[model samples]
Target: MTKSVGALTVRTDPTLKEVVVDGKDMSVYVFAKDTKPGVSSCDGECATQWPPVPAADAEAAKGLNQELLGSITRADGTAQLTLAGKPLYYFAKDTMPGDVKGQGVNDTWYASAPDGWKAGVKRQALGVLDHPKLGKILQDKNGRTLYLFTKDEPWR
Candidate 1:
């Protein structure tokens, strides 16, 4: 179950916790072109497609971190909820609770993480690459190579 803190909430994904708005499966997004931190660049037509996440009531936060939660005043003077200074938004096509249609739209928009981080797609390796010093290196299904640093500790 997702833990609700006022109008905002947190949902667990495989790698990290995601922010959900309005207690629904709606995943919030951040625009890459939003040059101004703590302010939303999406407005007018853009705002119609990506609706801003409304701020939670002043006294209502359940499991969300208070420090990372905040609000920003939009051009229309409406207050919208912000996480880690990034304004949150919802996708239009996500009609269901668990829809992630907005995960990586336009390479500019992405699902918002609880820590105000952006999630990346996980790729599977199909073959290996011949490295000069590293020898044979693992490559993803798309030919992207990956590396394991010697300084990294083993997973427990």
Candidate 2:
């Protein structure tokens, strides 16, 4: 699938994907490292376990127009990508495109929706949702609405 957000062009394989960040085309996965929408949390030694969602040079990163391309400071004080104010990250084990090798891991990391180009609500939005049967909603930092994981047991 070809998904675009700001300057990011996400090319998803049957399992994995390649996304453009900081003006460079880097690989990402369908899964995310945290409950936040388009962001990640793993950094430093944590990054050693789960790699970062690569970003381009600081100047280039500023070129990204997608609202979801927000950044967060890591433990080491480096900026990391955040979606809807939440951090974004990638898994180390996913070796190939279209490979969802990190689907459901550690009960925290899982597949991410292609909401990188827009603002979205957080997973927490589902809590106050009028409809409990509606399931979990995913949002980018822009607060734009996006995908909702329907499985009750998936995120838990």
Clashes of each: 2, 23
Q: Write the per-residue lDDT of candidate 1 for residues 1-156, one digit (tens) a residue.
A: 212325556566655345444565567777788868557899999988998877756222454555666789998887887766777788899888767788778888877755454645433446554332344657665445566789988994
Q: What is the lDDT of candidate 1?
A: 0.66
TM-scores for every predicted model: 0.65, 0.48
User: How far off is residue 95 in model 2, in Å?
Assistant: 1.7
Q: How does residue 6 of candidate 2 score in lDDT?
A: 30
> Which has the greatest TM-score?
1
Displacement of residue 70 (Cα, Å) in model 1 is 0.4
What ranges in model 1 sit over 4 Å off?
Answer: 1-7, 14-21, 56-63, 121-156
Per-candidate RMSD vs. true structure? 10.9, 11.4
How far is 29's C-alpha from truth in model 1 (Å)? 1.2
Flag regions of model 2 displaced more than 4 Å.
Answer: 1-7, 12-45, 57-65, 116-156
